[model samples]
Target chain A: MTEAATTRRSRITPEREAELYEAVLDLLREVGYEALTMDAVAARTRSSKATLYRQWGSKPELIAKALRHNKPTSLDEIDTGSLRGDIHAMMARSDDCQMDRDAALMRGLFHAIHGNAELHQALRQLLIEPELDHLNTLLRRAVDRGEVAADNPALDFVIHMLVGGFVARDLIEDRTVDREFLTSYIDAVILPALGI
Target chain B: MTEAATTRRSRITPEREAELYEAVLDLLREVGYEALTMDAVAARTRSSKATLYRQWGSKPELIAKALRHNKPTSLDEIDTGSLRGDIHAMMARSDDCQMDRDAALMRGLFHAIHGNAELHQALRQLLIEPELDHLNTLLRRAVDRGEVAADNPALDFVIHMLVGGFVARDLIEDRTVDREFLTSYIDAVILPALGI
Candidate 1:
C-alpha cells in the first residue's frame, strides 16, 4: 500500500473506528450538536485532533459519520416473510438495543439540523433514508403479498407511526421507548392500523 | 384605580400585548431562539428594549408568553359529541390557522428547549400540556359515551399518533403538517388505530 494508505489503515482499525464513533455518540448525547466539539471527541477518545480533522473535516460531518456507523442493524433485517412478522421482528430486534440513549442523541440533534443545511443533508442521507427505505421495501412486499392493500392510505403515515413514538415520548410521557412501550405500540397501534 | 394600576393598564393594553407577542413570534421565526434579541423585538414592535425586558425579564419567558397568548382555540373546541367528528373538527380548526409558521416557531424553539430547563418546563406547561390535556379530555368523553373502550391499549399512544405527525413531518417528508396531511392522517392511521 502507499504510505498514505498504510498510515490511514494503521491509524484507524475498524474496532478503533467503532470506539471513536461510540465516543462521538456519547459526547453528542451529553452535549448537543451546537456545543459538541471535535476537540472534545478527540480528547474523550484519546486520539489526536489532527487525526479527527483529517478523517471527517468538520463537526457536523464527524457527528454524521458517528451516527451512520452506530445505526442499529434492525433497519436492514426486517424481512421476516410477512408484514406483521417483519414489523414484530424489527420491533423486537430494535428493542434488544439501548434505545433511550439513541432517542436522546436523536433529540439532541433535532435543533441543530433545522438551521444547518449541510448537517441536515448529511443526517438525512446517512441516517434517515436507509431506514425509511427499508420500511418502504417491507410495505411493498406486503402489498405484493396481498397482506396490505396497494392503495392503503395508512401506508403514507406508517413512518409517522414507527418514528413518531420516539419523538413524542418525552412530550407525551416521561418514559423511554422501551420494549413494553414498543410491544404495546406494535399491537395496539401498528398491527391494528395495518389491518392484518 | 390607584396611580400605579392606572398607569399599568393604560401603558400595556390587551391589544398592545398581542402586538408585542406577534413581534416576538415573527422575530423567533426569522432568527431562532439563540440569535433573537430583545432589541430586535423592541425595534420591530416600535417599543423599547427596557419595556420588553421589564415585561418578560428574559427571552425564554418572552417567547413562552408569546406562545401562550397566541395558542389557538381548537384545543377547547374538540367536543363535537363524536370521536371521529371531534378529531376531524379539531384537525380542521387547527388547520384554519396559519400552521406553517406555527410549526416553524415550534421548530425554532426545539433546540432551546432541550438545553434550557426553564424554557422546556414553560413550553410543556404553558403550551403542550393544555393542548394535550384537551386531547385527553376528548378521549375521556369518547370513552364515557362508549365510542371508545376505557381500556383500549391504543389510548396510551394516541398522543403519539396525533402529535407525531407534526414532529416527524419534516423528518419523514420534506413537508409541513398541513390540513390535507392531517385529514389523511386522521382517516388512515388514527381512526383505524383507535378501532373506530
Candidate 2:
C-alpha cells in the first residue's frame, strides 16, 4: 500500500526477487508462519527488516509476495489433444513435482490463514485464485476441444477434491504422494464423476 | 499400561468418566494441546494432577481418552433399506452433530499430532481408527444388502474424500456444514464415484 512497498519489488531485479522469495519459503518450512518474523527473514536474506517492510507492508504481504513469486509453473498449458490426457498430465504434475516444499509451506500458510482475515485474503489473491484460474483455463480448453461436456457440474468440486485430498492425505497420514493414487483417482473418480 | 490407570477408569462410574473427559476436552479447546497440562485440567475439574497422571499415564493418553470418550455416536443403524437413504442419514448426522467441537478438537489434535509421535499414534488409535471402522461397517452392510458392490474401487477413497472434504471445507472456507452441500456431494460425486 505504501509507495516504497509498491516500488520495492520493481526496484529489485527479478533474480533477486526470486532469491528473496525462496529464502522466505525456506524460512516458512523451517519455522512456520507464526514464528516467521520479517527480521528473521531479513537476517536470513542478509537484508534489513526496514528494506523488507518497505517492500511488503506486513507479514501477510511479505508472505503473499513470496507465495506469488514462487507460484508453481507445473500447470503450464499442456495440450495433450484430449481432456483425459490433460487431466492425467495435470494429476501427474500434482503428484510428482507439486507436492514437495509447497505442501509443507501450505501447512504453514493454512495456520496463517486461520486467524488472520487479511492473510486469508492475501492467500486467496496470491495463491488460491491463480491456481483456480489455471484450472478453469484448462477446463475451458477441454470444453473448446469437445473432450468433455460444457456443462460439467463436477468440475469445480473435482479440482477441489484433488487438491484437498492430496493436502489432507499429506497432513493427516504423512504419506508420500503416489502416482498410482493420483491416476486411480482420476480414472475412477474424476473421469466418471464428470460423466466423461 | 499401568494398573493404577485401569483401576481408576474401572472404579470410577461411567458418568464420572464422562464428566472428567468433558472437562478435559473443554480444557483442550481453551488452551490447545501444547498448553493443556494435567495441572490445568485438575484445576479446572477440582481434582489433582496426580489423579489425572495416575489414570492416564501421560498427556497424550489423557487427550486420547478425552477424544474417544467424546466421539459422536455413529448414525443410528438406518434400516431405511436403501444405500442412498442410509448414506444420507449418516452424512446428515455428521453435518449436524459431529461438527461443532469436532472441528476445534481436530485442530488441536492436528497440532498435537505434528509435535509428538506418541500423541499421533494415540490419536490415530482413538479417533481415526474408530471412524474408519464405523465407515467400513456401514459399507459392508450396504454390500451385504446388495445395495453396493463388494469390490467398489472408490469405497476407501469415498470415505477419505468425504472426511477430507468436510474438514478442508470447514477449515479453509470457514463455512458451517450445510445439508445441501452434503446431499449434492452424495448425488454428484460420492455415489457415482462408487459406481452406485
Q: Specify the CAPRI tier of model 1.
A: medium
- Cα lDDT tens digits, model 1, B1-196, are 3676456546688888888888888887766676677788888999888877776677887887787677554455557789989877766765535677766676666656766777677667755777777778888999999988888888888888877788778775766788888888888998888778
lDDT of 1 by residue, A1-196 (tens): 3677457557678898889888888887777676677778878999889888887777877887777676545465557788888876666655435576767666667767777777676667755787778878888999999999888788888888877777677665745678777777878887788786
For candidate 1, the chain B TM-score comes to 0.81
lDDT of each residue in A1-196, candidate 2, tens digit only: 4676556668778788889989988887666676678889989999888888877778887887777666545557777877778778766665455566655666555545656677666666655666677667777888787866777667657655676566556645667567776777677677777767
Q: Model 2 segments beyond 4 Å from truth?
A: A6-21, A35-65, A72-74, A94-97, A144-147, A150-152, A171-174, B6-62, B69-75, B95-97, B171-174
- Docking class for model 2 is acceptable
Against the true two-chain complex, what DockQ does each candidate achieve? 0.52, 0.35
Relative to the true structure, candidate 2 reaches a TM of 0.77
**For each model, chain A TM-score?**
0.79, 0.76
Best by lDDT: 1
